[model samples]
Target: MPTPAATTTDLTGRLAVVTGAANGIGRASAIHLARNGADVVLIDIHESGLAETAEEIGRLRRAAHPMRVDCTDNAQIVDAFQRIEREIKSVDILLNNVGQSARERASEFWCSEPETWDFILKLNLYTAMTCSRQVVPGMRERRSGKIISIASEAAYMGSQGVADYAAAKAGIIGLTRALARELAPFHVNVNAVCPGPIRTAAADRLPIWEQYLKETPMGFAGEPQDVANVVVFFASDQSRYITGQSLIVNGGRWWS
Candidate 1:
């Protein structure tokens, strides 16, 4: 009988594409993926930050392709993925990490403006859908891939003032389940990582930062790497049997 292969988190030779790879969880996850042996494609609107992340990954002796893509614009996303296909050939893992809460415009549901809601939904939900479409066909044909999205704890445990953000994230969880089932037979695993208040530049700018710290049962917010750790797990073969699930990394904020 042949010896069984050891279960490990070795992503060597895989190519991972991470949206919003300019900073926070995206940057952390991208770097972590590279550390584990995967070459990464960094996609973000922030050119300088993408360069910085690419530099860090290059130091790991892995290839890093940085692309400046305004995710909210479907045209840009289509163009970017076209370039990805032409230049990189294939994508083994995809991290849909681009999201925003529009905290500065947070308000009562009744007071929220249509434009604000549109912006929030476009940035958070639509971008994920668009990006997934770009890679799903190839993944299905190849019969192996991983799709991980960065959702939020707000999706499950509702929050005041950010209803649009919460709704968008909930949509992500819904998408994950449906896509997971559809792609399961093809060996594609789809999952979402719902992070609570992680210590990111965006989180620090939110007005409810203090409130988030107080609510977390762990007594403090988590770091970006905390979520990145989970991202790496889902991206690897170690999570081969897990799909259509939302893993929360919010320091016990919600027990789902």
Candidate 2:
């Protein structure tokens, strides 16, 4: 087994495409990969934020490319992959990091708006499927690739107010397993990191964050880097023999 220090240095020269890279775990993952010598392309729906990420990564003496893409749209997703292929030549790693969670009570689908449920499904689950579809062909041809999806711990331990979110995350786990089996022949690994409550800007306003912290075994929620580090591990050659797995990094709050 490779030690942590050894794995950090193994990602050098890899090319990674990280979706939802404008902020939070995605941004940190892109930066972390760059710091370790990977050329990164940041993808997100936010144009200005993506530019800022690119600028910051450029300051680190590593290359960063940002593209504003609505990943839920299959046409747009396909086009972005093609553009990246033509412009960057190859994408050795893919981080499906875009996700949305609802605060509505769980098991209350009767009260959920159809539009809201649809949007959450498209954002959290279908987008991963669409993006992976575009990238796997190239990976199969190259006979090497890493596909890492960011899942939530709620997928395992159901949450109170996120039925759609939990369902989508569980769906992602199933997708990861199926893809792993399908891609194993080509040496492409598919996995997910299910993080517990993270203190990102988007979740800062939630009143329940403190409650989650209190319940956590570590006595605190996690940071983006906590999740990013696991992502980097799955995306690198260090995990050449690991696949079809979901590594839960939840501060020991929940273990299976």
Candidate 3:
């Protein structure tokens, strides 16, 4: 049997791969992971943002490898992971964080185009599956790993004008539970973090930003770091016994 994770939160010597690490929660989570002593591999399509994130991690004295890959493309994802395995090391933690609501094209579901739904589903759901596929083999072989995907409260609350986004994120929760069950025997943990009303660059651009704040029970929007803290918990030994669970980080918005 594989050895268990240590009882503390220290991530020393562990290698973590975080997608969408260019900014927002992805960037925050990567930084937090590094602060906890884990070397991180940052993946994103934005080169400038990746560089900035890497620089910050460098200041923390933790190894950070930034890879600019369009995660929506399966070929690119496969190629990138191949490079990761060859150049870096096997990933001990995989953060499937690349997703978008495609707010630019937001419309009522009846008015939504198939093209928009396609983009939303691919970016929000398929990317997680593809990225997880890359690391699952190695993790299963090693009999230990952590896979965390960033889902959204919209999945449960059923927000308007984002049906596609909600469906995609809901798919993430479903994927987490199924994969967790499948990998549990190998000591791998699969989980989802669902954030609500976090004040991200993307969220700030939403037309309903003011409405979201009003609806939030906390009476204020959350920061990316708020969600990042929960992510760090799942990434550390603190969550070793937790799997197939979706932990909501929204402040009193919805209860599970």
Which stretch of 10 consecutive residues in model 1 shows the poorest summed lDDT? 1-10
How close to the true structure is residue 91 of candidate 3, measured as C-alpha lDDT? 92
TM-score against native, each model: 0.97, 0.93, 0.97
Give candidates' CA RMSD values in order. Answer: 1.7, 2.9, 1.9
Clashes of 2: 0
Cα lDDT computed for each candidate against the true fold: 0.94, 0.86, 0.93
| Candidate 3 Cα RMSD (Å) | 1.9
Candidate 2's residue-wise lDDT over 1-256, tens digit each? 3444444446777889999999999999899888778899898999988998898889988889898898877798889989999988688899999986864333466677777778888998999999899889989999999999998898999876777888899999999999999999999999999989788987776657788888898887789999989988898778878999999888888742
lDDT of 3 by residue, 133-184 (tens): 9999999999999999999999999888999999999999999999999999
Candidate 1 local lDDT, 112-223, one digit each (tens):
9999999999999999999999999999999999999999999989888899999999999999999999999999999999999899988899987998888888898899
After superposition, the stretches of candidate 3 with alpha carbons farther than 4 Å from their true spots are 1-6
